[model samples]
Target: MAFGARARLINPRLGTYFSIFAALYTALFLLVLIFEQLKFDESFLRIAFLAGPIVIYAAIGLCVGTNDILCYFAAGRRVPAAYTGLLLGASALGGTFIVAGTGAFFFSGFDAVILLMGTLTGFVIMAIGLAPFYRKFGAFTVPSYLGRRFESRGLRVITAGIAAVPMLLVLSAELRIGGHVAQRLVGGSANNLVFLLALTIAISTAAGGKRSFTWTGVAQSIALFLAVLGVATTISVMVTSLPIPQLANGPMVRGMVRNEVNEGLQLIKVWPMAFQLPPEGFSALTKPYTQPFGSIGPLAFIIGVFAIATGVSTAPWLLPRVAATPGVYEARKSIGWATVFSGLALLTISSAAIFLRDFTLDAVMSERLGPLPQWLHNAAAHHIVTFDQAATRLGFAGLKFDRDGVLFALPLLVDLPSAFSYLLLAGAVAAALVTASATTVSLAAVLGEDVIQGMSWEPPTTQSRVWIVRGFIVVVAFCGAMLCVTAPSDPLRLVLWALSLTGASLFPVMVLSIWWKRLTVGGAIVGVISGFVAGAFAIMMGEMGTLSTPGAIAGILGLPVSFALAIGTSLMRPEVSRHTVEMVRDIRVPGGEIIYDREMQRLQLRKHSRT
Candidate 1:
């Protein structure tokens, strides 16, 4: 009872939750404010900007969900697919989408909104692969599923390795982009030193395990939803004229073509930066969407998406939630909705960011030249800080592309005050929390179940399991943080790089293993290897602007080649078991539904069919 009383006093959720919530926003907001008000050194701002996402992400990642058996509700079976998808969509969009997607997903300038929408729409169809099929198996992660299906440690080892790489790579991109977005939101210099940000994420992630991190997701997810709503409303009010922003950024581009307005739309000019005009934005190097083509054609885009979809499907982070769901149906429902929501957000947000980043140059100029009294301007305008030292600014900080005069892009981008902006930022932060929490918990699961005890064995005591996860959280966080020191500049590219790796290694094997009865272990091995190799090759080609166009054509081709090899080998060999074939029949339904049953007699009959 004494301990219980102490626990209540010390482990307060409501207050700590809100405080973290407020701090998350305030810390990020303050960084932007310093620049608008003080005109601080850009280097410092870059360095400083890294702090919030890392810290907030870490803090949220450590929040736990009590698993008193009751905590493991039958969400998987009970929740409708649509509702599950909604939650997933909302969760996957996280902080970055809120900041980058909503802030930038406008029809006015860069036509960025359109690009993101395309990605989202494509993903909607894509999520189907994961929902029923993955849910049916009742596996938590891609690798775990591989382990279960193959019953081959060799296969599981390779798959796990393949799956983990992309996650690590993408985490770097997320951190970098968060820093970039934060830098702009703060104005000039967030003083967020890169190491500071890295350290914060490391510390926070290391704090707890699955128990602590789930709530962090809840807190962050809630914050993100609210923030997006607020920002969405604010953007609506600011541009009462352009109804197009609501329709989708791409449509506006089409309208531009229809009205011949696109022909005359001049690129916004911000000093020290050059962005693309709408007519040929992809061709423009200065624009964020500019493909790293090195000189390749449009086909690279297709290849890139296919790889991203195939390679990065079963994130390590998404597994535990799969475990927690009530049954296969619930899990399916969640994944389907998750795909759509994430896809939409990715599309809308990406397009909006491109639009904002491109057009904001002009917006900056207008804000500067417009006739409002200087004093009447927001607080950011009233004060400005400047830094002179060159070497000092560049070291700890990150890149800041000032798209124009003093009123820079960051704060304007995030100044989520009033009704909408604040809410949006909150949402962005919340999303960050969700990803962080999910990732941390998933990592814990991996370490506790896979690495420490092997797949067949699980911890006997909840207390022991919790401690194992907590210990691993610290170790993993340290390693990941160290990687962030060498983080890259272009976040989008970085994300793709990691995702492509996944496409190469794991995509084909999983698909064939689930869909085809004749697929053999040898075939699975060949497919994983060949597909991975092709994926890597494709990524290089796409990045270099070489073999692409039908978009995802590379992935389509790569997987088939890999699958063919696997099947050819399987047919050549004799280990093709009747049991495996029977297992396949049990899972793959007309609509691809899976039902779980513990009844031993029925299970024996099901097993007998395989023999």
Candidate 2:
């Protein structure tokens, strides 16, 4: 039995299959590169190469289809820690992280580094505060766990509604960015590209559910990691004559800062005081380019960091990945691995942004309105790279940068081979699709299992439940795609909006539910609703185009109100049931599998009995 368990964990067949697929795709990519170099107008070849991998990935997902809800929902609770970690990290590193986040570093300078730090610290909070317990509780999803813990269907339904907001918003942002990438690669309508990408995601997600996303996420992570590392390393070597960009790019950055100052381009003090913003009327003062806290002062910056950290800790899509792990120990270990992966990706992205900025400055200064590079012209055509030549004498004129364009524009900015640019775009697409699929699954799970099932008069049959979940995947994907077409906010801002909502509304109650035995259903519901209202209002005020400071401090406004209301209301109300009390104790103990194992057996028995 021990040997069989170990073999199952190792899953040699899956490993071999993945290795073969990777080699095949790599060979195909190299072939396409060669064709391009031969001057064969490889537009068709490039599209074929890019589209083929996605189809193959979807086919693999379909091949792995399962009727078991346990498998569909949580991969049968048998995935090893390493795969779980990779999937979680990949899912977390969405299109926003890959495509728009680099632009953020270009725009916000070092202030954006705070957001990255908050994300890493969030995983630490998850590993220590949430993952082990959530695994031990053995719930299929976060809302389901909340319902069981609080012994209230209303709480489950409300949590589901609240959770859906951020999931849908984030999904829209992912689709929007994915569309931009597809447009860059294929040269088509952005809306059409989004619909196609959404269709692809829906098909892949509906076919194998969480199980498919797990394996595909591993592939996506590898592609993104390699693409980022390769681009950043290559650019760093070209710029500073050093291979390690994270270290060597400092001098380049310093040189850029000196040039900007000498040219009378407004810039804040470098290092330590990088939080200061440039004066108004600077062309670079776009959305996030404004003061970090607007009028809320420095304390708002600290609040923003904690808000993002809390959001990452309690995000609906991420919680299910942690629950899929086989045991508490593996769940905790998976978060550690996830942190390492995220840290490496973050390092690469930051370095890439810095290097690109320096490269762009040098290019513009050298060329000075004498016809820019081909990549810049392409980007300008797409409205990604704009130029403001009104102040050409300042030597910083003619360059208006958008954060969303930095990653995709980097290859062109440095004049790398066309094949490398294609590879990077593919990486961005992988990141977007992987995240969209995971979010779709999580959204479907919550809406179908938690909302629909909780509101049902009778328990849904296993087959009916599976169908409902699959149906929700299509519906959610369509809605997200539509929003992608209509939503006006940039990708990074959309992501920040979703995170701020989650941090303000869900994080407070989620933490207390596990740590505070006295937390009553009334308190949980009240806190969540109040936080949601406050957070939404704050966000709306910011969106109304009148209150910058209110939006910057939106999380601060909602979080404290929710925390206080929850604690105050819980003290006024009665404590929860004894079972709930003991469950809390159960989560804190280590190396236990009886709870999850029994749950799995129960699900298996139900699946077999129904058939």
Candidate 3:
């Protein structure tokens, strides 16, 4: 009771703790920028900027390391909503959103808003429909929640195996992007850096599981916010003389539209599902910035948004973080806050893309300019932006830009202080590390607890279980890092693929299990298998170039089949028990003892009586 009281006292102070960390992190980077301006060695400064926060995050993880069962797995269920929200928001942004996602906006123009809308819409669904109820049940992993809800250990094990696919995909995406940023900083092989970054993630995750995961995630989020918003605001003030990037990009967009007309860019009305790229002699810069369906088709856009949003709503890594919150209401509130933070990060990214595009249109492609700017040359040296040898002045057909490197290249492109570029690099790495840690830890928990323990009739001791999870964290991080090095995909597409898989395979059954009490174990098992297979098939086809937009298409094919299968199967085998029906009814209520905990206690009592 005294410990609980002390925790309550500390809970409200979390915001203050994170705020101080943000201020100090910003101030340290500012000092580094000042040193760079004062003729300090660029190499040392780059190392310091990237390495400093990671060291602190590891220290924090070590300090918070725990063997207590609940705290290890769920942060003692004491984190305040605001901090939990920060954790969720930061993990959601990942390395992909701030890095490759920014590049997508720069190239795809209006078509990229589909990604933003999908993510924010997913947050809304969680806030209203999913998160609170999950909190009330208080399961450690999504598989555990489903397994217990259906009273089937086999279902839990099967779901754990299926869910690991998308979680590892997300982990690989974060590691790949993080390694890229690290390589940009230190100028070494990205494969080595990926392994190194994975070590850092393992340290942070294995130290305290979600307990350490939460605090490190908050620190990383603040770093990301400082770097991304700081760069956007500075560039906004320089370009438009306004500090707010989101509200100040209007004239820039109009400027782009006018430039597109001057360049004689014409839109091709392709079939709605056809894949389109800029025609030869045309580059992304030569296309209309405000036009829709210029790249991804209209049907693909809608499907992409739906897939991403649904995936976000049901992400195993994301939803389990809600278990750290104090109650169901706090979980809902945290999701609301997550929506705000992620939405802000995304909008700032779009605004930054606009200002960067404005730079290219006004300077790089200008007929009067004698040669490409030194910044573009520098970008090309980094292999960030490429140009055609046969390229003519004002013709974009000869230019190509790598989307994944755009965010790191933006400050240089905009001619900001080189220090700002390093700052952005640090920020991107932080985002990646935090997310990689979250996904790694989630995979470990799902496999370690939901699968290994669920398969055993006898539960392991609390210490053994914690050690088991820590061991799995290291293994999972290694696998993800190796995957990143071995078969790297575009980070943005990887993210979308993970979201599509999670949404397609898990969302329908998760929802039905909560609202439809008649859902039988056979129905759920079949539904999960069917959805996963369909989603995986579509993803493979897309990867093989059979589909224009595989991530979105996966959901379009998988969701309906899963929903139909689960419902039809349930109706066919209408044999749900009265107790399960009562449990589902209880979960929907906001205030109650955690339903999962009560059920576990009853099972324990029965076991004791039998023994």
**How does model 3 score by TM-score?**
0.94
Per-residue lDDT tens digits for candidate 2, residues 51-127, read 97678777877887777877888887878887788777777778878776676666666666666777888899999
Poorest 10 consecutive residues by lDDT, candidate 3: 274-283
> Which candidate's TM-score is highest?
3
Q: Any runs in candidate 2 off by more than 4 Å, and if so which?
A: 1-7, 268-297, 364-384, 388-394, 455-459, 545-553, 594-611
Q: How do the predictions measure up, each by TM-score?
A: 0.66, 0.89, 0.94
Model 1: residue 140 alpha-carbon error in angstroms: 3.0
Each model's lDDT: 0.46, 0.74, 0.83
Greater lDDT among 1 and 3 belongs to 3
Clashes of each: 75, 1, 2
Which ranking of candidates, highest TM-score first?
3, 2, 1
Residue-by-residue lDDT tens digits, candidate 3, 515-555: 88899998899899999999888888876878665443454
lDDT of 1 by residue, 455-552 (tens): 44222355665567666655555455456555453444444455455555666676677777777777787777787777667656654557532222
- The most accurate candidate by lDDT is 3
